[model samples]
Target: MTLRRRILILATAVVLLGAVGVFAVLRASSRAAEKDRAQDGGPRVTRGEVALAPGDGGRRIVFRNMAWGPHRDELATVAADVPEGPRTASGVNCLRFHSAAGTGICLRADRGGVAESHRAVVLDAHLEERSSHPLAGIPTRARVSPGGRLAAWTVFVGGDSYAGTNFSTRTSILDLRTGRLDASLEDFAIRKDGKEYRNADVNFWGVTFAADERTFYATLATDGKTHLVRGDVVERTVTTLRENLECPSLSPDGTRLVFKKRVPGLPAEAPWRLFALDLASMRETPLAEERSVDDQVVWSDDRTVVYSLPGDFGADLYALPADGGGVPKRLMPSALAPAFLD
Candidate 1:
């Protein structure tokens, strides 16, 4: 071979090897990005734009915003301070607040890559994890009792009915202090119309604890009808209270209950209206927020109620008067599952 031709062939081989190295590097980077997204629940976003800062220790609020991507786990102030959307608990997809004790319940899902298995993680007042419990089904709700000694959660289980109007949920309550778990409400004795009732198709969800940790209110669905029932942890008994109520949240004062009630003539997708039921009078008063609120309402104070509404990018927290008047005010943008730290 000529010396020039030999040199040309060597140079061509070197260039081909360099190209192969670049391609390998690109593939590795792409895989790393995918892993980050999986861990963070979504893509990362720039801070100081749609992010809120974690405020001082006292009376803080924490929420999740999938739109914030890596900063989806966020902390803010009860006064609606700019949230510090830091990357805390990167694996927690859902979270809720225990206002009285200043703790939280965080949920993490492991579906191989999608959502299949879930774990209920207990978070301390400072947003640090304490313990986690393995759970079945997709996580939908998590709540801590007023004293924070007990925690409960609900997950949708069985069938593709969640995509449609009908669905089933398996709600569990954990005694945080003793680590005792009531895996399913189905095991509890239920009384309807002052008589013991047993049904295999019965399901319960959306539990709100009373001042006494042993007593709670939850939605019980059976035989194609939904009813609000008051349950006792000690007695392991549930008694039906009323009909057509879902996701009841007890008032901070313990005199009223805020929940979602189905309103006729609305589309099934957005069929609920926020209503306050007086415990003494049993009168249901509709709140001023006209939009469909598909959340368990939280009491910001005795006079104001807070909840999340879905937005274009993510869900935002909104607060309105608890007395059924006044417009709903936006509390935090790109935040959901508002839990006030007291």
Candidate 2:
């Protein structure tokens, strides 16, 4: 072909690609605008003061509201007793959130740039921003210490899900009182089977803080297996407690842990089942929830646990008996990452 004809062909191809890109952007914009509009038959949401502190209403359940409306993805609250009632939106948006003793950790996304970014924001009792730190990847799990002096969060630095063998996660713990941050838990020393351990593929995520400020529990994945690791903030070490458990949420009384156990013979897509492990006895009891639960459960009380499941809008909260006997009940619709204030 002639040089002029070749140049013309290249120009035509560039124009076609530009048009396709514009179409994709327009489609995405349209979908986002649709989310801003209130969906018919959805729960009522109103802008209101949503304090992290427990008020006269007794106890409140703060969660990431997933209902379709103007307040979608905002940190909202409801009476702990009546979780399915009207939501009070705090105007603070978060992809993942958790709170304890009036302090909150909110993992939020920044959508303004060409590539999306995430950050962990510390919030005061009044739902106001206290501090923010940039996160390396997509946020997943977040938790605050029982006394509210420490905050922990986990993000997916690679791959799509925790179940994937090639996935990588970065778990960070922040000292709220001193403003100190542990950017990655991998920096801490690892002790497996009473021996010091190290590996290039080691990844950590799904942290749950104990009442004691120095102690915590998290999932450490290495060598195609996940373990429940007991970590010490002061010692800067993590000791493996048990294997095949992920996302362990300790009970308020600190006697047991409710975690997702990868049960054999289950489908790979949904391999986890809720199980309660007695810390003292080293015994595991499978919870009644038949479906797979892929969340770091929140202990609603000593006897009950709450977790999120895929729902119509996005995700819904479900409560189950800690004893592994009672059936799972829908706690609330269009809610995720619940933190109870009492």
Rate residue 73 of model 2 by lDDT: 95
Which candidate has the highest TM-score of all? Answer: 2
Q: How accurate is candidate 1 locally (lDDT)?
A: 0.74
Model 2 quality (TM-score) = 0.88
lDDT of 2 by residue, 85-128 (tens): 77888899999999999899999999997999999999999988
Cα deviation at 179, candidate 2, in Å, is 1.2
Give the per-residue lDDT of model 1 (tens digit) for 255-314.
999988888998777888999999999999999988988888888778988888886556
User: How big is the positional error of residue 312 in model 1, measured in Å on the Cα after superposition?
Assistant: 1.8
The estimated TM-scores of all candidates read: 0.77, 0.88
Clashing residue pairs in candidate 1, if any? 52-83, 52-84, 53-82, 53-83, 53-84, 54-84
